[model samples]
Target: MDRPVNALSKAIRRRLGPSRLRDVLHGVPLGHPLHPAMAMVSAGCWIASAVLDVTRSDPRASRTLIATGVGMALPTATAGLADWSTLHREQQRVGFVHAIMNVTATGLYTGSLLMRMAGRERTGRALAFTGLGAVSVGAYLGGHMAYRQAAGANHAESVSHLVPLGWHDLCSLKDLPNGRPVRRRLGYIELFVLRLGDGVSVLADGCSHLAGPLHQGRVTVEDGDPCIVCPWHSSVFRISDGSVVHGPATAKQPAFRTRLRQDGVVQVRPAD
Candidate 1:
């Protein structure tokens, strides 16, 4: 499964590449993954159609709903696949099976729609009920992948609540490598600290995309602004205020204001 999944992921990446379409699909503009919201459209239509079927309501309405759901599944699936392509191996495997289930359900619904058009309403209703079951399983798998595996979750810990209101000592100024990023401890949270002579910039160590350690990431200047690229997924963040320049990550990494004391200790507090 890993081998084939990897191959398929590669294909998807190649097709998607880096573009505005990919950014939209990744939900960078929306600040969340688009698939879950898109999925509800199709799911709602199918569920409504099933309810109509059980109550023996207007057959015409049921037919319309089934067709709508079938049509919407294409865009819903495209969004899900775009997100799945950027996930980890375990996540991709689960997403692959989830996609298979959805595809099966879609096929069943398509056949049911055709059957009803051919005057076999009873068989179509039966097939629609079966599709509901398949889609239910797929929904469960999608939830598992999103929740249990923490895929597509914002991994950066919010620091405003944890840290005290006042400035606190971070580490000795001498400890940080000059012009390079390094990890430092502050309270219960970790900090990604970079030094340039007397100046320092601080950001939360966890990558917002997947909690990839930002301290281990490489630094580069983009548009003359110092930026750090997440090693896990290459999310580029401006070090000045931790704003995402490029993503998989839509959420901003928490930034901090830093000052150096005359005694050679660095002090930091949450940027207000």
Candidate 2:
């Protein structure tokens, strides 16, 4: 599977690399992965068709639903593939099988639609029911990946909750290098600290998207505002406020407010 999956992954990267289209597909604009939301359309249509079938409703309505679902599969699958390509190998393996099941289900529904048009109503209905079963399995795997595996979850949401509600000493201002990002321990949570001239900025070291270390990432200026690009997956967040400048990461990195004491010790507390 690695050979083919790796090849397909490379192809997808080549096509969507660093483009707004890739960001759209990745749900960067939406602040969550688009695949799960897009999938609901196709899945809903098919499920509705199944309900119509169970009730022995109008064949035409069922046929239309099946066709609609099949038509929507292409875009839905494309969005899923885009996210799948960036996931870890374990998640990718599950996603690969999930995609196969959906493809098989789509094929079955397409055949069902064609058969109905050819006047073989019974065979078409049978195929459609089978397709629903296949899609159900695919949906189950999708849920497993999302809920159990946490493939697309925000990994840094626990920062504020985990940190005690008060100012904590970070480091002395002189220990930090000017204009360079560094990691510092603040109780249990790691912090990304950057000092420029007399001012200091701090953000959670773990990225909100996938726990990628922001301190290890490179800094760049976007629209004249400083931003940090995740070294793991290239998620970009504004340094000043930890807002997402670009994603794959929907949630902002937990930003911290900082102050310098008269003794030049840096102190930090979770920003409101």
Cα lDDT computed for each candidate against the true fold: 0.91, 0.88
Per-residue lDDT, model 2, residue 49, is: 85
| Residue 229 CA displacement from its true place in model 2, Å | 0.9
TM-score of 1: 0.92
lDDT of model 2 at position 8: 86
**Which 10-residue window in model 1 sums to the lowest lDDT?**
17-26
User: How well does each candidate superpose onto the true structure, as a TM-score?
Assistant: 0.92, 0.95
Local accuracy of candidate 1 as per-residue lDDT tens digits, 1-272: 99989998889879987677887877888888888998998889999999999999999999999999999999889888888887888899999999999999999999999999998999999999999999999999999998999888888877989998999999988888898899988977999999988899999999998899999999999889999999987888999999877777878899999998999999999998
Please state the error at residue 35 of candidate 1 in Å. Answer: 0.9
Regions more than 4 Å wrong, model 1: none
